[model samples]
Target: MFDHIQIKVKDLKSSKRFYTAALAPLGFTVQYEGGGAVGFGPKGAPALWLGEGDSRGSVHIAFAAKDRAAVKAFHAAAVPAGGKDNGAPGLRPDYHANYYAAFVKDPDGNNVEAVCHKEQ
Candidate 1:
């Protein structure tokens, strides 16, 4: 429903590093980078944009994973890249039978997540 989302972070370089690794497993790449801003998404679409600045507040952004394995990979990549674990990867029946996901807080404390909706 949304074309793109922009997030303000205290440090662009650090945020870029964190997100570059965090989103890789989900198949997102740094599509554009210049002028203190970086955009990430699939090949031609930069749906998530990160700009250098002071954030007004933390935000939660979730990316769709191809499968359960991708969700696990995102969690693994995030931690070493400077993310704090918010939730481990597993099935959350509360959300749905196949709502497998993981959550991590980025360097700026934004809740980043990867989720797969299909049953394995």
Candidate 2:
């Protein structure tokens, strides 16, 4: 539904560090960087952009994971990468069967998640 998203962050460097590590398991990386901004997504296709500026509170951003293991890896990596644990990786039966996901708060406090909806 969206081509790309740009977020204003209080610290671009910290955000970059956090995202680079957190999104790795979900297959995202820095694809572009310039003009005080950085973009993260699959190779050659940057979707999420982060720019240095005053934070506008927080927002939820969920990335698709290939499987439950990726979701768990995301949580394990995110916490040490400067993200705060919002929710541990597990099945969210309320959402649906096989809704495995993990949540973390990014540098600017945005809720970040990696989810896999496939049954194991």
lDDT of each: 0.96, 0.95
Which tens-of-lDDT digit does each residue in 40-80 have in candidate 2? 99999999999999987899999999999999999999999
User: Which tens-of-lDDT digit does each residue in 1-120 have in candidate 1?
Assistant: 899999999989989999999999999999999999999999999999999998999999989999999999999999999999999999999988999999999999999999999988
Q: Which one wins on TM-score?
A: 1
Off by over 4 Å in 1: none
Off by over 4 Å in 2: none
Clashing pairs in 2: none
Error of 2 at 94 (Å): 0.9
lDDT at position 72, candidate 2? 96
lDDT of 2 at 116: 97
Q: Which number leads on lDDT?
A: 1
